[model samples]
Target: MRRSLQWVMYVAIKSIVVSCLLLFISGLVQAQQQDQSVTTFKELTIKSDWLGYPTPETVKSHPGARTVITNKELTESGARTVEDALRNVPGVRVFDESGTGILPNIGIRGLSPLRSEQALILVDGIPVTLAPYGQTGLSLFPLTMNAIESIDVARGGVAVHYGPNNVGGVINFVTKRIPAKKTMTIRETLSLSPSTERMLADSYIRVGGFVNDKLGLQLQGNFINGDSIRAHSDTQVTNIMADVNWYPANNIDIKGSLQYYKTKNNLPGALTPESYKQDRHQSTRPLDRFTGDTLRGSLIYNQYFDNGAEFSWTNFAHRSNRQFFFGDALNADDTSTLERSSPREFLVYGSEPRLSFYINKGIKQKISIGARYMREEVDYIVDARDLLTNEFSVARDWRFGNHAFAAYISDTFFLFDDKLKITPGVRREQVYLDFRNNQTGSKESNPTKDWLPGVDIGYQITDAIFLFGNFHESLRPVQFTQITFGGAQAAERADNFEVGLRLTPLQNIGVNLAAFRIDFDNKLEFVSQDVGFRNLGKSRHQGIETEFTWQPKQIDGLDLRTGYTYIDTEQRSGQFKGNELPLAAHHQLNFWANYSRADWNWNLNGLYQSKSFSDGANTLIENEEGSIGRIPSFWVWNAQITRNFRWDKRKIKAGLAINNMFNHNYFFRGVDFSRGRMPAPGRTLLFTAQLDF
Candidate 1:
């Protein structure tokens, strides 16, 4: 009763603040309305500033494979984590180690998913990696499920605008939009895992609205506290975010965002084959744990001119700290007397400005030009501790820095009455690296540059069908370790090609098919700790992807969507030549079905992946240590049901979800030092409730 009263009081205070803000902003709106000289153009809308496509209809003209998951689809699928939601996209792979998505291992196409090194992750077009230029690894993902509004995945044709490590592509998360009227939401979720006898809880609160026609503000907070399905695995996560949108003038718009995220979690270290078979849900390495936090902010400004031209400038900065502690042992069961801890800190700052306009010289054309500059710094340290005496000593200390600059230009030509479209673009990149071994007082510096070029072609054969193709060159800057401690001196490069078509056979049915190939050179692979990192020669990755969706008119409130991917990868050089890459499954499939009637909703989902290798050698038999082996094929199913209730101008939603309905067991071979059989989660259930006003 006391907690309830506190909530009531909080809500009342929030209402008072909202009312005052609205009244103050309404007066400004009226004054702005009196000045009719200011012009408002649709092209300068807030959506146009996003890095991803402005609207769903614009996707049809994309030069390469593109996938967008809407908020409705995510909510209806009962997606408790980002890894679960990414399974619906074709040619994408997800591996969960923490079970909470705090540390994501995502792969696009056939690239390695180790820390998602090859992929570029973004939130509202702002980089989220620990050090976007020096480290490319995502040690901490600072995002909450409730704060997301949509997801956009670009598989190819992005190098002209994005850079550094976009070899795999870009993944952008779009946050929830500010509402037109005052709104508030409170949500709670409870999850139970019978196998491990653990329960998890998640709480979320959001308040947002446009105070008036000229300004908008939003605030969101999410917290999670619970244990994973494994013993000794306890975790806590906190996230807070704020956003502001101000249109001081009719043709000028400004947006700002700030976020803080922190997490503390225990790592259920890998288990030996014997231990895994005996009890996969037990955690033997109780000393292993991880802690991380991030503080980020961004600002965007846009200006529109009467000549149908727009100028946009975006600036962002972030600081992050991550630390991991684990036992130092050759195998999971080894009796090691020493423990190791790695602490890393990063600071990043970036600015980008772009201009887009139209030109007509007997043929309609669109032109875009952009420039970017970014700086990143990292402090990496390694320390060792004696478990018996509790004594600590520093082993290695290093600092890395990077200065990067890029400029790009693209032009789209419309011919044959706008039926045929061709776009050609090029980007120039220059990077300067600085590294210092603090322990030895040694320093190294180097400079690298690259030229990336691409072309996209699209033909509208008919109103119902669109055909598109693209060929682009991309580059991955040399990693910090590669330049300072490894034998690699040149940057990695790849040529990407894709051909795809989108069509609608019926009013309610849509289909998309694409074929892609990537030829990569100077691929970097991590050797042992003593050997550091090295270039593993060339490799080839090619694949086919198809997606289908149907919303039949005959059946009210019924929807179906499915996607499939087939990838073929091979090593072209080195000792592993003629062998298939690790974790590159040959086939993957996903299916979803949903139906709604009145206030009731039902959803079902299915996912499957074929067998793959755990090591570059493609070992078929599991070793005694369980560090290398072939992963078996597995399939899982999920179902959910939801009901909505409304009364007295209040709305409420409740839902229940069952995951891994068949209780299927699956495991992945360790990628880092935790070398052994890492078992995945088992059957689980989730109950959720939400209140809106």
Candidate 2:
């Protein structure tokens, strides 16, 4: 573990160097123009402000690959869930097995799933992960899409300020910061469909004000209820949130927030081979049952120094418990052998503490760099039936804990005073991992040490065009979620190279094109099994992603966003090599158009992904020397309309959103196996209305 003193010393030295740079810049500013000397970035309304705040000026000077979705986009999309809204963004692919809530395996760049361990989900600067179980944001997400102010995606790699687990990237869902004035809000939504029906209610009310600046505090909550196509299956979730902020000091601010969530739902597990023959969405066995809940709190402190440097820290913690079983019924052997039995259970508790340093002005460079430390601890216990005894017993007890030490430095310097921009950066990370096994002592091992390094670069070709290229390496260890009786696997290593261009052929329109190739060694691959999974070897992922967005400055209310992705894969060395990536499409296209005016808002969203194979083998069946399995490609659509009304100083917006608008049923992902598949949700309509005063 890195001692606190080491962290402090690391930051102190960097801060001293940065302070000196700032002083030098101050001296030069008198000779040059203030506005002209600032490193101006191509600002977008979507808030690429991923590195810091929403000021377009601040982001242009940020040091990493960043992308954002604005508040308007979030509201206009009429997306049912947070992940639903983000999937349309380039470089983001969300694969859900069923319509059962959100199943997010959010991959960035060309990371291999098996080795893709790190990726952080942040809410109000707080890290959200179900510890012990290692289920990415399982306890914290499924957020109501409309409440978010924007979604910031820090692509490639980022520092640990937002908390570790983000080797692939960091996604921060910055919710609506409380308004500066007293206000009240009430919102409700109802959806009815063949596969599911849900009702959600949430409200927020701000009270009181700080000394000079307006003070703000608010409360928000949501409830969702639904059922799947299977037996003895139903799902429910309730989330409550509170936030308070104080900006008494003009240059300093502090905010505290808390969120509580509960879910009585199923994992949408796989069905047997026989069930597929009857109906892809049908199941005979009572393969259902799951329940879970979570609670968390966070405190964030931010300070802005007059010199243009900013600093912040986020402290957060959460706990969760979830259970799974074969519906509410018990099997003959399992029940007959035991006097009393309970469903399988998993529990987690964790805390994430992050510190960030943002320096916007420097003598010789336009830079944003910082160092961060994250300590996350997790514990897991499982109970399964014995082979002969048939009675369930303590099958596994595991403890997963890691402390990460990371630092990054980057500078984007301007040549010719301001025209050309050149950026260079490097990051280093050291991780410590320990696993304790109660299943048996043989499984106990502590690989407590590893180091990874990263580098990135970008340059401007013309004022309207930019060229960027980067190469970095990252390590993905076998997280707690991958633990199985087969023995934990070794960490996977990846070396990635990418080169791209960001172009603006016309003002108000932006286009980005990137081609990437990643090589994976010791990639994690697994197979179906009870309790755990079976491992497979090395694999690779390489692909291309593009995005085009238009938010015309002159147009009063018109915004269009579109994205296309093309991915190519080579197994390298595995049961399946030179095969395309499965559970992922080779080609994906999405387009969204929105028109918002004072009285009404109109929106349309559409998506189509080329067919993809299932599982790593790409092969369908195995029992009788081999069979066939293939999932055909599909298309999907969604649209919404909203109108606002007022009642005695209160503001209200009513809207209807239709998913799968054409009612064409499809597969969430191509399914190929006796394990059966889940049909995508049929055409569904959601009615929602919100009131604010």
Each candidate's lDDT (Cα)?
0.81, 0.56
Give Cα distance to truth, residue 496, candidate 2, Å. 2.7
In the range 1-693, model 1's lDDT, one tens digit per residue, is: 434533543453344344435544554465456543333323236333324443467577777788888887778878878877787899898887776556668899988887888899988887888788777877788887789888888887787888768877888888887676668999998878987779888899998766556776788999999987887678899998877777789889877777889999998878888888888888767678899998777778888888878898987777789998887443445566788999998777778998888898778887888899887778889999997898989988998888899999988899988989898989999999888899888888767798899888888888889898988899888888777764536778999999999999888899999999999998776666787667776899999999999998999999999999999999998789989988899999999999999999999998898999988999999998889999889998888899899868889999999888888889877656678887777888989998999
For candidate 2, write residues 49-114 as lDDT tens digits. 226654334433333446777776666777666546775766665655435553454666534332
Best by lDDT: 1
Q: After superposition, how far is residue 382 of candidate 2 from its true place, in Å?
A: 2.3
Residue 482 of model 2, lDDT score: 62
TM values, all candidates: 0.92, 0.78
RMSD of each: 7.2, 9.4
Record all residue pairs in model 2 with backbone atoms less than 3 Å apart, i.e. clashing.
Answer: 41-60, 119-165, 210-215, 273-674, 288-327, 571-578
lDDT of 1 at 163: 79
Model 1 vs. true fold: TM: 0.92
In terms of lDDT, model 1 sits at: 0.81
The number of residue pairs in model 1 that clash at the backbone is 0
